[model samples]
Target chain A: MEPAVKKGPADILYDEVWELARTIVDARKQIGALRPSKLKTKNVSAALLEMDEIVKATEEASNTIMDSAEIMSSADASDAGYSALVQENCSKIFEACVFQDLTGQRISKVMTTLELVDTHLQDLQDLLGPEFDEPDDGVDEREGDEALLNGPALTDEAISQDDIDALFD
Target chain B: MTANKKDMSILIVDDYKTMLRIIRNLLNEVGFKNIDEAIDGVTALDSLRSKKYDLIISDWNMEPMTGLELLKTVRADATLTKLPFIMVTAESKTENVVAAKQAGVNNYIVKPFNAATLRSKLTSVIGEF
Candidate 1:
């Protein structure tokens, strides 16, 4: 307040640099917010694991029914009624395997999200332009495999098994 | 050129371990015994080079290489060109099917398939079970 100090180019440059630093800090916060939540991924992973166990259990149950049917059929031919019941139960177990399809679809969606996040992070990294080291050449590690990177289709968009079968005809 | 399903050496390629297990189980249900597995297309190509496989069942969405890429490579190779390759994928796009068909995939199976569908597809490709 004693005297008015005229800002020089150096001072202006310093302020500009400080503003850029602040902008970077803000960008970091924004990125942190934009990043895919680890909690969501963890939750999905846990659910998928549970689904897998359930699917395995169903498969095991179906196998047991088949084995039991085989043993009963070999041991005695008069147990047709019991065999029919077992077959019906096996069919139900097989139907339960549909969970695999649904879960697979869901998991694929999550994977797509993760992949998108990865791409964003990569893009951000490129924008930052190597704060510590030389800039990366922007080559994909799996560049040769890029052509094959088609992830799973969304459930609604996926072709039905019947449709695929029709191709054979 | 049908091979015995039980005796045929098959390679199952997929990025998902669960999928690999599911396919192995399904193949087992259909009487395929000599089955081996690869986690992705790279390993699949290596396996194919090392030893002969009667059939290949591969998932499309894989890293470092996809089932479609593997199919293209297989078709490009003189020795492996005629190998009976089946693509199993969750993708149902007509374009995807067209691409696979253009690449010379022996058969295609959409995901959420059961043993019956798999069996039928196998029959279609390898002929009569």
Candidate 2:
């Protein structure tokens, strides 16, 4: 019977590191597959593109309706009742523009998800040995300026324009 | 001489075309007719040099040069210093606000914002519309 050999701390640490590396690789693959630009089974890019089209179409339709209404209202012999109705309809079209705001929020969320995945992949690469020469993307050295470059605030965490105004006061 | 709010020549700098369009539309709603756009700070600086804009509204995060960089550049330039500059960003951090203020930003707006918020910011920086 062979004697049992106990693994040293270095050996145990190596195993743990390799395990982490594998898990990171798996996570990277999953994120890449799910990314919007991937165009895979669950592509978020497609949904965003579809929403973009919808927003464009809706805006165009709304603008056309508003233009026609304005022309009709300006006519010399425009009926008072019809003019009022046109104004009301135009107001509704303006309100319907709220879709752009909602869609903008959704697109921002998708962008955040993609950014998180990218950061994780970068962190993983840093943990492991560099596989390739580091490119001069200018981002790594530019970290100093990016400290205040935080992108849009989440709805719940966002401050109001009034609050900002009070800051100056 | 201060430009009238409605007639003010405005330059809007943002990396996102969607955001530029949204801001343009909001500006239109608020009666600003003359609006120009640049996709980044470098381009924005060029636009500022070529033409005189009554006001500048810029986003904070852009490649090559950021809105803060742009603001600092405008403030440093003898010709462009004192330009009414507004910084629009999603970052609501106190440090960022202080940095922008120290960099000579006339006002700061945090996203996502509506036409009313934009109007208020514009009014505060420029004057009553």
Candidate 3:
């Protein structure tokens, strides 16, 4: 027979909490790992400014985590009371904030990376011709890129160009 | 950060004036100039229709129109298809993330975020910085 699975109350709670915690941690680690290479591409002054913001945010998030841990440890998980409910809710709030904060950090990092990518893409595009920048001025090409990026229109309810023009007036 | 002359313009939309101002200031610290603000999604939609914004950062929960609704509208507009949109919210439930991802949000930010977190999310969503 297969062995029976077992998870204690504290074990379950910890697991749940840790699952979210791990997401936050892993995301932050990714951002941290990406930063050094990113800094290489940016100017010193800009890097310094970004580094300062990152450091301050890191410190603040650390404090929040510590506070959450303290709260979780002190709260009576077994107690079927209102205070316990409040504690649980508060704990969830903290975890959610952690994820949000981590995501925010990650987004900034991604943008910087994109900036680098855009620079590289622009360089490549420039090498081709002025047309590279205006690749889709035609209605069909413009429609194609739009549809490809944003998906198809919700409805097929068509209106004439004069109908649209009249509304513009 | 290598100064290649920051070209991005951020339009922050929130129901709360305080929140709008705060987000704008935070973007400023990130070396972003040409920041604009709107009090709610209605005003935001108007601004979005008339101007070309490189980025649209909006609060998720608002009166009349929420961030998700605005995001949907933005996605529907062919002129703004490639524009990156982010939803800033106090809701962080797992389902919320799933929903936002489904609604075509390029990224998300939770309320009470500090400078680093904000910067990081922008980097991850927009590029690797």
Candidate 4:
């Protein structure tokens, strides 16, 4: 505006550097919106947990149904026709019980996806520094019912029936 | 000689109603009709005190008192010390088995078991059905 002064290469470079810096700050602010604290209360984890509970509930129900069906199939051997019908229906129930197995596998896949999400969120939190870390709520992760009911260990720490029998021996 | 298979008094303990029903049904099918049930170790203990049972088949996981705890309590009691107690559980951890053995459990059976397996364990503990 004064006398049409021509900007030098250094001044032009400084303006360009500041513009790039402003853009980076804007990007950082956008990323900061994705707080790691949300992972605790987010539906993603809660939904996955619900899916796990569904698998367990379905397994229990399926077991009950299958057990009942087995009992019925074995009942009234004298009534050949009725017994045959029961045997056939029981077969169907047993076949239908596979749904629980399939559903369990499917939920397992979803749980894997949830794990991936958790891993990525963890990575993001790491990148964001300890300032984004959540405070400890002082909750102990209990297994089940006061007792250490860790229901069928998946690790190599689990033993076999033979091993258990050996203990009595 | 062993007592009649059907005459043997047995008690099955578990917190799950479905599991109790399944075990009861299986025991009935196997001709052990003289069977009682309790929902947890505490209930089983009360039942044990009030009635006489030749065998105790219990789940290891339960509220207030676990089967392991019950086994320890039974071993501590003078009359129940000699009682045949079998701990039935899905937990097949070696440490858990060691604990049960240390607690003086007569036998252990893993879950997802069949009537035949249950019968075999029962027979092993209470002298052949």
Q: What are the per-candidate TM-scores when only chain A is compared?
A: 0.45, 0.42, 0.34, 0.53
lDDT per residue as tens, model 4, B1-129: 226757878889999877887888878778877889999989999999999888888999887888888988999999889988888898888767777887888888988788888888878977656
lDDT of 3 at A126: 52
Best-to-worst order by TM-score is 4, 2, 1, 3
Candidate 1: tens digits of C-alpha lDDT, residues B10-63: 999998776787788778778887899999989999999999989999999887
Query: Which lDDT tens digits does candidate 2 get at residues A1-169?
Result: 9998899999999999999999989877865654535543344555567567666756665565555555554555556677676677677667767766766776776676567667756765665547654657766354555766667666676667677777787
Model 4, runs deviating above 4 Å = A1-32, A35-49, A52-60, A67-74, A109-113, A128-149
Candidate 2 total steric clashes: 1
TM-score of chain B of each: 0.96, 0.97, 0.91, 0.94
- Displacement of residue B102 (Cα, Å) in model 2 is 1.3
Would candidate 3 be rated incorrect, acceptable, medium or high by CAPRI criteria?
Answer: incorrect
Candidate 3 structure quality by residue, lDDT tens digits, B70-95: 88888888988678888776655444
What C-alpha lDDT do the candidate models reach, one value each?
A: 0.77, 0.79, 0.66, 0.79
Q: Candidate 2's residue-wise lDDT over B1-129, tens digit each?
A: 245669889999999777787788778878888999999999999999999888999999998999999999999999999899999888887777888898899999988889888988888887888
Model 1: iRMSD? 4.3
How would you order the candidates by lDDT, starting with the best?
Answer: 2, 4, 1, 3
Residue lDDT tens for model 3, A45-148: 46456666765665555556545554554567677784765666577556746655664775586667567656655655654458647666556554421222
Model 2 complex DockQ against the native: 0.34
In candidate 4 the C-alpha lDDT for residue A79 amounts to 76
Off by over 4 Å in 2: A1-143, A155-157
Candidate with better lDDT, 1 vs 2? 2
